[model samples]
Structure formats: structure tokens, C-alpha cells
Target chain A: EPEVTQTPSHQVTQMGQEVILRCVPISNHLYFYWYRQILGQKVEFLVSFYNNEISEKSEIFDDQFSVERPDGSNFTLKIRSTKLEDSAMYFCASSERDYGYEQYFGPGTRLTVT
Target chain B: AQTVTQSQPEMSVQEAETVTLSCTYDTSESNYYLFWYKQPPSRQMILVIRQEAYKQQNATENRFSVNFQKAAKSFSLKISDSQLGDTAMYFCAFVASNTGNQFYFGTGTSLTVIP
Candidate 1:
């Protein structure tokens, strides 16, 4: 079965540096999303992207966070400046339709900021 | 806003025994979707089962089944004849049909199936 895939399974960056987490969603998927989980916390929604624009975002998705589908296949989340709290497992998910469909998740990218 | 809650922080089941994980949600929307996801030690999020709020019949996938109580706003997962491999962290999630499809996940329940 086709699955969502993310790059840089593990990323380490300086506290003030910028970081980009990339994902390649299923080819036919129309909606994409980004979520994060602190080491022992529940997964939190970051943002949702569709039609090259942000459809929805959570309070945690502040100015520092941005998502882009630069190409037909690549969707990326960029943190303008990483904070220690930003260190978590970032996951990318996609669904074929907008409603009632299950979102398929990627293995996730572990971001570590020191 | 939608919220999912899994009250059990941890649970254990003996191999070949049956186990049930409880979940509850707060949502006003009449139409929505509930999901159960499994994350093993590998940390990959896997979809274990799903239930549509409009459906009265429960959803089952082999040994994995759900007890969905729409009126009570409860969705629970039951694992029958549990195996050692069933050890993992399980999360309950919700998504409203009219919303932007953002998933609301619970804190998760850590289940260990003992051999």
C-alpha cells in the first residue's frame, strides 16, 4: 500500500537555527497536515494545508511555523527559529478526501533542538 | 472544538486474553469520525480501526473491534485473543465532518500484552 514518507528521520539543530521537515504525501491525496508530539505528551495539531494554502492551524502554530507544498509531491514544514520546546516527533498525514476518510500518517521525523 | 480523552494511562493483558481500552470525546457536531491508532515501539502511527458517528453498527477488523456509543460520546477499542505483538501505545482521535479535518488526539493509553 502507498504510504506517506518523511525525510531526515532524525534532525538535530541549534536552538536558534531554522529547521525544515519534509514530507512526500501519497500522490493522489488532496489534504495534508502536520502534527507534533512532545516526548510524553499527546500529539498536537500544527497546521493543515490544501490547495497551496493553509486551511487551519492551532495556537501552537505561531509565526515561527510555515508549511509549503513547493512541488507536486513535496510538502514541508519550516520553523523559522527552533526553540527547545520545538523538539518533538513531527508527523505528516494525508487523506484522499476532505471528510470521513482516515488520514494516513508517516513514520514521523524526530526533531531535537539543543 | 473537539477533545478526545483516554483515561487509562496504562493497561496490561495476558496473551490470548481479551482487553478493552476506553475513550471518550466532547463534541457537539452530529457528524464526525472517531479513530483508534496504534504506535508500537517503532513509533510508527498505524490506523487500527475507525467508526463513523452516523453509523449505529460498530466497526470490526479481525480481532480488533470497536464499541461506539454515539449517544454517550464514547468509543472504545477491544482486542480479543491478544498477542504479545499487540503491545503498544493506543490513541483515540476525533475529526468533525465540517471542520478542516484536523485530528484531535487523546493522551494515549500504554497497553502491554504479557506472554
Candidate 2:
């Protein structure tokens, strides 16, 4: 079965440095999302994208965060400046439709900021 | 806003036995989706099962099944014939049907299948 895939399974960056996490969602999927889970914490929603635009976002998705669908298959989350709290497992998910359908998740990229 | 709660921080089951993980949520929207996801040691989030709020019948996927109580706002996962591979952190999630596809996940229940 086709699945969402993310690049740079693990990322280590210095504090205040910019970093981009990349994802290649399922080819036919129309909606994409980004979520993060700090170690030992619940996964928190970051943002959702459809038609190459943001549909909704959470408070944690502040100015430092931005998402882009630079290409047909690539969906990326860029952090303008990484904070220690930004270190977490970031997941990318996609769904074929917008409503009630199960969204498939990627393996996740572990971001570690020192 | 929706919140998913998994009260049990940790649970264990002997190999070949059965285990049930509890989950409850707070949501005003009548139509939504509930899900169970497994995050193994590799940290890959895998969808285990899903239940549509409109469905009266609980959803089942092989050994994995759900006891969804829409009225009570409770959704629990039951794993039958538990195996070592079943050991992982299980998260209960909720998504509103009519709005953006953002998932609200619980703190997670770490399940250990002991041999």
C-alpha cells in the first residue's frame, strides 16, 4: 500500500538555526497535515494544508512555522528559528478526502535542537 | 475544541492474552471520527483501527476491534491474542467531520506484551 514518507529521519540543529522537514504524501491525497509530539507528550496539531494553502493552524504554529507544497509530491514544514522546545517527533499525514476519512501517517522525523 | 483522554498511562498483557485500552473524549460535534494509532519503537505512527461516529456497529480490523460509545463519548480498543509486536504506545485520536482535518490525540497508553 502507498504510504506517506518523510526525509531526514533524524535532524539535529543548533538553537536559533532554521530547519526544514520534508514529506512526500500519498500521491492521490488532497489534504495534508503536520503534527508534533514532544517526548512523553501527546501529539499536537500544527497545521493543515489543502489546495496549497493553509486551512487551519494551532497556537503552536506561530510565525516561526511555515508549510509549503513546493512540488506536487513534496510537503515541507520550515521552522524559521529552532528552539529547544521545538525538538520533537514531527509527523506528516494525508487523506484522500476532507471529511471523516482516516489520515495516513508517515514514520515521522525526529527533530533535536540543542 | 476536542480533547482525547487516555487515563491509563501504562498497561501490560501476557502473550496470547487479550487487552483493552480505554479512551474517552470531549467533543460537542455529533459527527466526527475516532481512531487508534500505534507508535512502535521506530516511532512510526500506524493506524490500527477507526470508528465513524455515525456507525452504530463497532469497527473491527482482524484482532483489533473497538468499543465505540457515541452517546457516552467513549472509544476503547481491544487487542485479542496479543503478541510481542503489539507492544507500543497507543494513542486515541479525534477529528471533527465538518472542519479542517487536524487530529486531536491523547497522551497515549504504553502497552507492553510480556511473554
Candidate 3:
């Protein structure tokens, strides 16, 4: 089965620095999403992307966060400036369509902002 | 907004025994989906099973099965013949059927299968 892939299993950045998390979803998948989990906390939705644009986003997805499908395969989440509270495990997920119940999730990238 | 709740923080079962994790959700929409995901120490989210809200019959996957009661907004996962490898944190999730808006996830249940 095809799975979502993410690069840089771990990332460390200084406060106020920019960080871009990369993800390559399944080739034929049509929906992509970004979620974050603070240590020992529930996963929180950040944004969902489809048809080359954002479909929906949560309050946590403020101006500081931006998502773009720079290429046909690469989905990137850029954080304009990092904060201490921004540290968490970021996950990338994809599904064949917007209505599917199953979404393949990639091994999360742990971001540590100091 | 939909909210999934996993009231059990931790559970344990002996090897070869059966274990069930409880999950309850609040959603006004009748059409939706429920899922159970397993996350081990690696932190890789693995889909264990899924249940479509429209289906009345329960969903079963190998040793993993779900007791889905749509009217009560309850979905529970049962693991039979539990093994040491079955130890992990299980999360119950909810997603609307019409859109890829967001997934509402429960806090999580940590299960330990002891030999």
C-alpha cells in the first residue's frame, strides 16, 4: 500500500526562525492534511489542502502558517516564525478523496523550537 | 464542531486475552465516519479499523473489531488474542463524510498487553 512520506524525521529551530516541513503524499491521493500533537496531548488539526488550495483550516492555522503544493508531489508547511509553544510532533496525512474515512499518515516529524 | 472522547486513559490485558477500549463522540451530523488508530513508540499513526456511520453492521478486521452505535454516538474497538506487540496508544477519530475539513480525535487510550 502507498503511504505518505515526510522528510527530516526531527527538526530543531531557534525562536523566530522559519521552518518548512515537507510531505509527499500518495501519488493518486486528492486530499492532504497537516496535524500537530503536543507532548501527551490530542492531535490538533492545522489545515487541509485539496485541488491546489486550502479546503479548511483551524484557529491554530494562523497567518504564521502557510501550506503549498510546490510541485505535483511535494506538500510543504512553512512556519513563518517559530515559538517555544510551537514545538510538537507534526503529522502529514492523505486520502484518495475528500470523503474517504481512511487517511494514510506518515511517521511524524518532531519539531523542537527553543 | 465534533469532539471525540476516550474516557479510559490506560488499560491492560494478559496475553491471549481480549480487551476493549471505549470511545464516545458528539456530532449533530448523522452522516460521518469513525476510526481507530494505533500509535506505538515509533509515533507512526496506523489505521486499525474504520466504521461508516451509515452501516448498521459492525466492522471487523482480523482480531480487531468495532462496536459502532450511531444513535448513541459510541464506537469501541475490541482486540482479541492480544499480544505483546498490541501494546500502544489508541486514538478514536471522527470525520464528516462530505468534506475533508478536519478530523476530531479523542485524547487516547494506552493499552499494555502483558505476557
Candidate 4:
């Protein structure tokens, strides 16, 4: 089955640097999302992207965070300036439809901001 | 806002036995969907099963099944004849129909299948 794939399975960066996590969702999928989980915490929704624009986001998705489908296939999440608290496992997910469909999740990229 | 709650933080089931993981949610939206995802040691999210709020019939896949009670806002996953491979962290997720399709996930339940 087709699956969502992410690049740089692990990322280590400085606190003041910018980091862009890349994801390639299923080719025919319509909706894409970003979520993060602290080592022992619940997964928290970051943002959703569809039709080339952001569909929704949580309070944690502040101005420092931005998502863009730079190409028809590559979806990217850019953090302007990383923080230590930003260190977590970031996951990318996609679904063929908006509702009632199970979203396919990628293996996830573990980000460590020091 | 939608909130998914998984009251059980950890559980254990003997091999070949049946186990049920509880999940409940608070959602004002009538139209929504529920899902159970399994994450093993690899931490990869795998879709175990899904249930649509409008569907009265439960969803089952192989040894995995869901008991969805819409009126009570409860969705629980039942794993029959569990195996060692079934040991993993399970998360219950929810998404409202017209609410932009952002998934709300519960804390998660860690299950260990004992041999």
C-alpha cells in the first residue's frame, strides 16, 4: 500500500536555527497534517495543509511555525527558530478524504533542538 | 473542541487471551470519526481500525474490533486472541466532520502481551 514518507528520520539543530521537516504524502491523498509527541506525552496536532494552504492549526502552532507544499509532492514544516522544548518526534500523516478515512502516518522524524 | 480520553495508562494480557482498551471522548459535533492506532517499539503509527460515528455496525479487522457506542461517546478496541506482536502503545483518535479534519488523540495505552 502507498504510504507517507518523511526525510531525515532524525534531526539535530541549534536552538536559534531554522529547521524544515520534509514529508511526501501518498500521491492521491487530499489532506496532510503535522503532529508532535514529547517523549512521554500525547501526540499534539501542529497544523493541517490542503489545496496548497493551511487548513487548521493548534495554539502550539505559533507564528514561528509555517507549512508549505512547495511542490505538488513535497510538504514542508519550517520552524523559524527552534527551542529546546521543540525537541520531539514529529509525524506526518495523510488521508484520501477529509473525514471517515484513516490517515496514513509516516515513520516520523525525531527532532532534537539543543 | 474535541477531547479523547484513554483512562487506562497500562495493561497486560496473556497470549491468546482477549483484551479490551477503553476510550471515551467529549465532542459537541455530531458528525465525526474515531480511530485506533497502534505504535510498536518502532514508534510508527499503524491504523488498527476505524469507526464512523454514523455507522451503528462495529468495525473489525482480523483480530482487532471496535465497540462504538455513539450515544455514550465511547469507543473501545477489543483484541481477540492477542499475540506477542500485539504488544504496543494504542491511541484513540477523533476528528469532527466540518471542523477542518484535525485529529485529536488520547494520551495512549501501553499494552504488554505476556507469553
C-alpha TM-score for every candidate: 0.96, 0.95, 0.96, 0.95
Which residue pairs collide, candidate 4?
Answer: none
For model 1, residues B1-115, the per-residue Cα lDDT tens digits are 7889999999999999999999999999998999999999876788999898889999999999999998899999999999998999999999997675889999999999999
Let me know the TM-score candidate 2 reaches against the reference structure.
Answer: 0.95
Q: After best superposition, candidate 2 residue B25: deviation in angstroms?
A: 0.3
Chain A of model 4, TM-score against the native? 0.98
Docking class of 2: medium
In candidate 2, what are the lDDT values of residues A54-97, reduced to their tens digit? 99999999999999999798999999999999999999999999
If you assessed candidate 1 against the hidden native complex, which CAPRI class would it receive?
medium
What TM-score does candidate 1 reach?
A: 0.96
On residues A1-112, what C-alpha lDDT tens digit does candidate 4 reach at each position? 7878998899999998999999999999989999999998889999888888888899999999999998899999999999999999999999898766788999899999
What's candidate 2's DockQ score?
0.78
- Candidates in order have lDDT scores of 0.94, 0.93, 0.92, 0.92
Instruction: Compute the DockQ of candidate 3.
Output: 0.71
lDDT of 2 at A59: 96
Q: DockQ of candidates 1 onward, in order?
A: 0.75, 0.78, 0.71, 0.76
The residue pairs in collision within model 1 are none
Residue B2 in candidate 4, Cα distance off native in Å: 1.2
